[model samples]
Target: DSFKSAAGSQTAKVQQVVTSPDGEKRYWFKLEGGQASPGMGDSPEPVDATITQDYETAAAMSKNELSGTAAYMSGKLRVSGDLMKLMQLQGALGQMPTALKGIDVDY
Candidate 1:
């Protein structure tokens, strides 16, 4: 994920917790020396930062319709733990559209 690219030479674990009808769901990825790897389950393997937001907010943020920084400032997004990690990802959030370009989905 671009978040990992934004991590540069740092090592960080960024987790996202989204509210689900049953309760909550979690997704996360880790970055080490600029490489990204996905993680599974509700908790991060070694959480450096966590983002607590609903699916809608996440989607909006991902699509570039909403800014993570603005969302964080407006309470639409919440972050905990090492806020610095989240800060690094802030710019990557804006690149989602660019990243989505030239994609051909067979399905």
Candidate 2:
């Protein structure tokens, strides 16, 4: 998986929760295998880390109008669990065009 490949041995399950005006959405990534998808529910494996953001903030991240690191620093992004795992994947995460590339944002 792209995430696993990117992090190499740094394996973890990352959950992304988005709260938007329309509704809420969730996604997960198993960094070891780089597996990511939508929907929120129980997982057989444990979640090592989680990132929470509202739709607009996430969209800002995608367009590089804002940054996850900066957002996190400013408390716009909420993080829980294994912060190290997120940090380890920082390089990979930073390359993202948008936090949710599939979703459209006005920018």
Best by lDDT: 2
Off by over 4 Å in 2: 1-6, 33-44, 98-107
Tell me model 1's lDDT, rounded to 2 decimals. Answer: 0.70
Candidate 2 local distance difference test against the native: 0.72
lDDT of 2 by residue, 68-89 (tens): 8999999889999989878877
| Pairs with steric clashes in candidate 1 | none
Using alpha carbons, what is the TM-score of model 2?
Answer: 0.70
Error of 2 at 37 (Å): 6.6
* Tens-digit lDDT string for candidate 1 (71-104): 8899988888988767766555455445654555
In model 1, state the lDDT of residue 87.
76
After superposition of all CA atoms, the RMSD between model 2 and the true structure is 3.7
